[model samples]
Target: MRQRPVNLMDNPHADRVKRVAQLAGRSAVRNRRQQFLAEGPQSATEAIRAHLGFLKLSEPAQQMWPVGETVAEVYYTQRLIISHPDLFALVQQLPAHVFVAETSDQVLQAMSDAVVHQGIVAVVNMPPHSLQPSPGAELVAGIVRVQDPGNVGTIIRVADASGADYALATAGTVDIYNPKAVRSTAGSLFHLPVYTRVELGTFVASFQGRIFAADGYGTRVLDQTDSGMLNGPTAWLFGNEGQGLNDDELRLADQRVAVPLYGLAESLNVATAATICLYSSAMAQRRQDPSTS
Candidate 1:
């Protein structure tokens, strides 16, 4: 006989519901709690997988896990449990520390920042900021003071797709955990290591490889830069959307590389520029060392 699932929460105003909703709007709350909301089916699914993967690690490995326990709680509407039984099954695999609850549609809506809640949300723990990339990391994508949450998230996704070893959000960049940013990641948040609130100068000082600044006015155009330069470990730094990299910031990079523009468009979006620069480095690196591809 199949056991029926019960709705564990029905009140939209419940304390638990409000706590989850607060994570969406308040950075202070998120920082103090060290948790953020992963809303909608995709984010929830990826988070669940990350949590389960963590459980499979050996004890010592678990203790050293780069991204801490990925999910702390999961809330889903009855409609979702019925429509997404597979997702529900994955939720059931979560450990005892993870709170799993079934909520009414209204309750789920109250807990989500999305206009359409998608019937699911997961409270995910933030990864520790202490794990710096190894000196051998092949590629990294860094954003400095990029204000748009969507652009930040999209750049993270593009970095993941291009096989960058890590994504970095320097101080003043929009919160990567912002609901819009999380949604824009389309689950890539769980795919790669994303370090936030990094210090640009500190990172530049510690990084062993070349740092390429994505500048609109640079001596070296990206397409014409020496392929050998792109073949090694590299970090691409992108700046704020409107101003790009300021003079002082550009001085830190080993090279300033511009994406050649054919059309009359004045500039490329930060995320778009990041995609081009990252893929260029990724393809070049893979071509040089096929084993990494």
Candidate 2:
């Protein structure tokens, strides 16, 4: 007996109605549907460029593409009805393999999470990242037990801005693929390399340079720390917001520095602290260089 192929083009309206009527959470999107949501034009662009294998594209994003040009294959929507033409035009020229959808709502609902879905979303083939340490890349940011996706994405953005080679996240950290995290980076997710692991202390010890840990309670202030101490390749370890650095992890630090709180606030958010620390280190490195100025 021969089985007939089901046409996606057939009964398009019914397919769309069903998808819009039923939607699931972001986490469930991966497990139940075997798909995860990557929102915003920029994130969608990065995921496409990375060749992470985006399964489909939403209707409203048919025209909007990234700025620069690259030849990469991706599944994209064909119907081009965009309110923002300029933005859409830029996205149109990218290296995309287009797929005309049966209906907009079906594609929209299939890719969206809890938050309002950006006009564009992609179902990407998620690659499992390795936790092993890298060679020759000395500058590192260790996020231990930071739970929020927004904070995690912000830190990754700061790390990329500071030219840090890669980020190492410990167990109990937020899911890096969370839509909120992906959005907060504003496309910095593509610029940085990230990894997750259970053992941070062992990884930090393996690196060659000064190990600095950021803590709110530390007596040594970030500004007051000897600038020369960060001269060599450095690894900066930042901890959780509410609990601060765990006792065993703190023991690995060669220098523990604190960001001073001038106002009534008890402590800075983990992401904010990461931005300051990474920039300060970058400044120190720049000052040491002759050609940068």
Candidate 3:
């Protein structure tokens, strides 16, 4: 029998409500439940799109999925009507199995960690992608111990927009799934393949593509980068926010390329620097084949 939309407003302390809310704070809850809360309309839209193959890397993690469990669910506040037409329209396109529940404002707050809720949250059924590179993936981004979650999320967005094949985050980098990080992504989290908790040195050693380390004080300026170097597969390495890439890490890359600072600015934001680096590789790759460009 098909299920009907349920109204859940009475008990704010119900086990389900409490459990879902805990997802924002506890990684243990997310792992055990195999469901993470995507609070607000932006995350909801992206989480739904992930169901539609926005998450290409997730497919390989399906072995951990329980049997007969293709269905997913979404919850929202019926009383708290939002004027976001685009968000609602995206929700409507999802399959019928994604249940929508009507809840009160108090309940919505309990289910979200954000200071403000957009009256909607989607319970995304997602699996953790392993740190394996896809075949024929040329352009890759490597992130070191960038502790800031917002920077981590925004870098993923930069990778997605710059046509990077995938992103590999080494150990010590912030967890991509952390609620604050997820919120900062603004849906770019679901757009590209992201593999986390990797060993930077080990991965760099085996990478067949040219590795361009992003160093502000490096010898070669980005504009001076050779066209031939960009034509081949490439990997861009990014270091932490405070201390940049260590000596050992820098030695692993094929070349250390810096983005020239014309003005008096001391440095570029990690995400902004990464955006420029990724796009540089992307543009060069496209120039190698302009018909498709």
Candidate 4:
């Protein structure tokens, strides 16, 4: 005999439900369990799609899904109401490794990091990050200490859109996999490769080409700098959100280039500055080798 899927609507306080909810606020639990919650439909969907190396089974959803040897499970609450139309069809087509659960809206809210969860939450395994330079990488993004989850997620989205090779989120940066940050990514988290907790100086020293720092008051402006400098393999270093890059970090860069500001606005935000810098380099690289595009 086989086990049938159970509908969970009234058991918000169940041991299993509480365990999944722990991933939302507790890093220690996440670390111990080696998993983080991917809240909402877009993130939950992509969490299954990305095939992020290893996944563990949630005891509840295990019988219906979590089929593979390593076993991957995704918990979906209120989505059980409408997922049958599309999301369910999508997951059905995916490998049996993907497991889903149908639960109450209350359970989804409980598992979410936010007050409003968009009716889905997934506990996804965190992949191990390796920080080596991207092979044949044209442009790279390096993030250090910048603490805002939204900024970090947006910067990654920009880097992906601008066609940067890869990104390194240094030690002090907020958790890239945090539920709020994952929501901010809006699916780009699966599109881009983001390596975490890298050391700034060691990475810069080993990089094959020039490294540039985006600074507010630097000796060179984006347009003033030679286009040739942007053509080669490059790394762009962005620093702490408020204080900006420290002296030691700036010294690691081959150059510090500032984006021109004509408006009354005091300065540029890190994500905006990073987008401009990455686009400038990407366009320059495209010009250098038209066929590369």
Candidate 5:
């Protein structure tokens, strides 16, 4: 038999409820606590699965704490309990260390950052700074000083979907854990290692691969660029939306590559450009070694 959810939390202003709500509105609270809010059913489901996966890891692996310490607490409305019974069932499978609770609609609204809370939210621990891309990573997507939270999250999603080994945000980039950003990821954040607050110079030095800068005024066109160059390990750098890559940032890349503009459209959105660049590399890499596909 499935265990019933805890009693409803009806007070929107309860101390505990307020603290969770603050995570969405305040960066200081999140940084100090090393936690962020995963709003909606999609994020909540992924967070729960990550926590459960953590429990199954070997003792030594668990010590590394990669994805296991992900979900800290989950709060859902009565409607969610009934509407997403499957999700609730997954929540029931969580061990005693995880907190699961039922909340009133008003309490859920107060706890959520989104206009539509989707009747669920999970408090997720930020992966430790020590967490990094796997040693043998073949393709990586990097964004430098990209201020839009939505773009950051979307790029992470694209990187995951395109089968890139990992994603990263340079120090000046927007917070990947921002509520809007987290919502935009659509749960891909849980699928891979996404390093944040990284330094571009250090990242470039650490990789033994070709680096391509996605620039509007580059000498090489993405579609026309040598396929052989992208067949090996590669890292892509996407710059800020408005200014693109600065002179210094562009100098770090082995090549500045531009996605060709077929029509009168001014330029592609950073996320859209990333989709093309990453997919191109993914396809080339898979062709080079079918086993990786």
Candidate 6:
């Protein structure tokens, strides 16, 4: 059958589509080096329909956006509040966006990291954490000298799931909104607050809780601490993965603890150690909690 070649004009919106593509493709329209996109609902909808990958859906507002099958990830939450559950329900099923943000547009925009500020942003929720520990809140995590976004986000997730409270990242730690850190948190960034400080020594001094450092050759064993002083409100300190803790920082700790490693590996990753330390405290606290007991 000899038929006329179909014109893209037959699609009617072809020109508009081409313009949108041009806008999306241009570096200025997207973002340049060192600049990222903080998209709003308008941008999110556009991207969802456009099907761009690598967008890590964060918290709160991201949780509310509707996503298509082309989404890179969708991290949803039971904590999300919506007047239209059915509408959001559809967003939940999509595979693209990581449903993490709250319902506010302004917040979503603030958390957005891209240069364009897509109006809809990926915000990792840092739940309010108190210095004062609850009866059940026995475990604590602190970040010292680590400044990478990936490291911080990974540590935050490990700490939260391990049931740690009051994550204290020292003065040198990366800003939580560095995009890379927020993305690394997965959906766990929405779980707890990580405190940033201008001074490491003074910050730990102010912390009234028990302090322990995760060192390779420390005098104490992490596994044994569960039966010892770890049962109390404890803060587990993690040093930079490369340099470990400085001598001055080590002096600030009430105890220097080590994770028992039977394997040939030299030491555990700071994030992984943090998880172990936090969960150890959490398990002890859970066992001690009057209600749970």
Q: RMSD in angstroms, all models?
A: 2.9, 7.8, 3.3, 5.8, 2.6, 12.3
* lDDT for residue 151 in candidate 2, whole number 0-100: 90
Per-residue C-alpha lDDT of model 5 across residues 1-293, encoded as one tens digit per residue:
33666676989999999999999976668888999998998888877887878334333234323454777888888787689998888878876666788888889999998886798899988776665544356899998999999999999999979987788888788888899998899988877778877888888887889889999999899889777988989999999999998999999999999999999998999999999999999998888887866
Off by over 4 Å in 3: 1-4, 52-71, 79-82, 89-99, 129-131
**Tens digits of per-residue lDDT for model 6 on 29-58?**
322221222233432333343332234442
Cα error, candidate 6, residue 276 (Å): 1.1
Q: lDDT for every model?
A: 0.84, 0.62, 0.75, 0.72, 0.84, 0.53
Q: For model 4, how does the per-residue alpha-carbon lDDT over 1-293 read when each residue is reduced to its tens digit?
A: 11223665557888788988888775567767877777777776666555532233323223212333222566555455475445554444445445656677777677678878676666676655543444446788888888888988888888777877677888888888777777877766655567777888778877888899999978899988788888899999988889999998999988989999888988999989998999999899898897977
Model 6 residue 170 CA deviation in Å: 0.8
Q: After superposition, how far is residue 199 of candidate 3 from its true place, in Å?
A: 1.9
Off by over 4 Å in 1: 1-5, 54-68
lDDT order of candidates, top first = 5, 1, 3, 4, 2, 6
Clashes of each: 0, 4, 0, 0, 0, 29
The TM-score obtained by model 3 is 0.86
Best by TM-score: 5
TM-score of each: 0.92, 0.75, 0.86, 0.86, 0.93, 0.57
Global CA lDDT of candidate 1, please? 0.84
- lDDT tens per residue, model 2, 185-285: 77766555566554776677577777888988888988787778665688888888789888888889987889988889988998899888888887887
Single out the weakest 10-residue window by summed lDDT for candidate 4: 57-66
Write the number of the candidate with greater TM-score, choosing between 1 and 4. Answer: 1
lDDT of 1 by residue, 105-219 (tens): 8999999899988989999887666755555577899989999999999998898789887788887888888989999998888877777788888888889899999999987
Model 2, TM vs. native: 0.75
- TM for candidate 6 is 0.57
Worst 10 residues of 1 by lDDT: 58-67
Per-residue error at 80 for model 5, in Å? Answer: 1.6
